[model samples]
Target: MTPELTRDCQTVADRLRATGHRLVLAESCTCGLLAASIAAVPGVSQHFCGSAVTYREQTKVQWLEVDPDLLSRHSAVSAPVTDQMARAVMRRTDEATVSLAVTGHLGPDAPAELDGRVYLAVCVRSGGPGASRDGRDDPYVVHAHALRLHEQLRVQRQIESAREAWQFLVRVALADI
Candidate 1:
């Protein structure tokens, strides 16, 4: 992770700790980089839950309970998919109060349409319409980011996306959303 990303993750960690909330990560293309960055923060053990490095679609389905039809309709790297992935990971563990999900194609060799595209989702256990006391609808805070695929190496894109994810986390966590 880049130094900026590390600092952002630390900010997120500190903010989460201040609110007494722990985080769970569901990562796809960037793998565990986001989780590792948060773990690097001091006192993170109190605010970090765990992560699922679900690179394969099947793993997302099997472990995170992502709907296969949803993946088929939106592909694995979309905001809708990442939103569902975040909700799944957040609910899967009782320990976390917030969840962050990331999926993207950072590529020199990605599928034609997916290259350089990334989707992110952040879910707070108690803040949304879906997370109501009755456990009804579950809306997530979702976003998408992209860069020119040919403008950077795959590793560089991954690093950039990781940083973006950290920044997103900081925004939501600080707002207590």
Candidate 2:
């Protein structure tokens, strides 16, 4: 991992710990990269609950409990699936205060949809007064370069985007909490 990414993950982990929150991740296209980044930080176990690398459609359904009908209707890349992934991970861990989900196509060739078109969903459990009687849901996307490039460059850019995503999640989580 790059120093910047490591630092970002550490920053988010520290903030969540300070806020008395626990974190979890559900990942697809980015595989375990996001989880790995978070766990790399020292003392991550203090606030990092767990993560699921639900890379396959079946895994998303079986492990994350994503709705089969929703997956069949919109495919896993759609917003509903992303939201489900986030919520399911939160439920599965049963310890996370905040959960983050990421899904997308990282391709050497363009996808039917744009490559590097990533969807991120953050779900926060409701607590305290004025917290949503329900939970909270926020979804957004980050677009990164999609072209075929040197393997090193490709990995580098993905790490960069992952760092940015961590930062984005930090801002969102703070606001939500």
Candidate 3:
């Protein structure tokens, strides 16, 4: 990791710890890199709830309870699947106040249709009556409303870079919190 990224992660971790917030991660293209980065921080165990590396569709379905039909319809990289994965991680941990989900095709060879694509969803839980469909839904809604980023690279390099990108995003989100 770069110096800036390391500082970002530590900053986010510190804020979460101070706020008494817990986090969980659901990763696909980035594997478990995001989780590992957060875990590297000293005292992060208190706020880092857990993580699931749902790299395969079956794993996402079986472990994260992502709807198989949704996966079939939109593929694993779709916003809905990412949101579902985030929700499942939060539910399983039972203590996560924030959850992050990532899925994407990390290489130029990742099918013409999916080349250089990435989808990220961050869910933050709020305490309130009738929160309505969990806070994961809010992130999904925003995801649908946003303009996504796109970049092209070799498949092998993309996969490796996606991990770094996801970790960077985690650090940013932690800072925001």
Candidate 4:
């Protein structure tokens, strides 16, 4: 991991620990690097749930049970698909209070339309309507964002996207009421 990404994970780990929230990671393009970085944080085992590296569409369907039609329509690296992944992982894990799902195309040989596009989502289970005061719905709300980066080497772009994914999750986890 890059120094910035390591620092980002450390910050995320600290904030999640402070909030007494467990985190689940569903990784697509970044493989498992983001999860590994967070796991490197000391005391992470307390708040860190396991991760699913659903690198392939088949794995995403098999592991997270994402709808094949959804993937076919929006592709795997899309807001709708990633949001589904985040919510699905959160639903599957009793240990996790929130989940982060990431999917993207980092280039090298990606489809023309998907090149350099990354999607990230964060989901929380607060239980009850109007529980969240941060302008989001209660229970199973997936806040998703898409970013387009300069086309770079696949690994290099994946690293950058992973950093953003971690930072975004931390921000949501630390949001004020």
Residue lDDT tens for model 4, 44-153:
99888899999999999999999999999999989999998998898788778889999998868888888999999998877422243353544676678899978478
Worst 10 residues of 2 by lDDT: 140-149
**Worst-scoring 10-residue span by lDDT in model 3:** 139-148
Ranked by TM-score, the better of candidates 1 and 4 is 4
lDDT at residue 86 of model 4 (Cα atoms):
95
Look at candidate 3 and give me any clashing residue pairs: 107-155
Tens-digit lDDT string for candidate 2 (69-143) = 998998887778888888888777666778888776666574656455667787777771124434435322222
In lDDT terms, how accurate is model 4? 0.85
Candidate that scores best on lDDT: 4
Count the clashes in each prediction. 2, 0, 1, 0
For residues 8-119, write the lDDT of model 1, one tens digit per residue: 8878877876777778999999888887878888889877889999999999999999999999998998887898888899888777778889999887778878878888
Model 3: per-residue Cα lDDT over 128-172, one tens digit each = 112345545343221221122454444443344444444544554
Please identify which of the two predictions, 2 or 4, would achieve the higher TM-score against the true structure. Answer: 4
Global fold similarity of model 4 (TM-score): 0.90
Each model's C-alpha lDDT?
A: 0.79, 0.72, 0.68, 0.85
Question: Model 1, 106: alpha-carbon shift in Å?
Answer: 0.6
lDDT of 3: 0.68
- Give candidate 3 regions above 4 Å deviation: 128-177
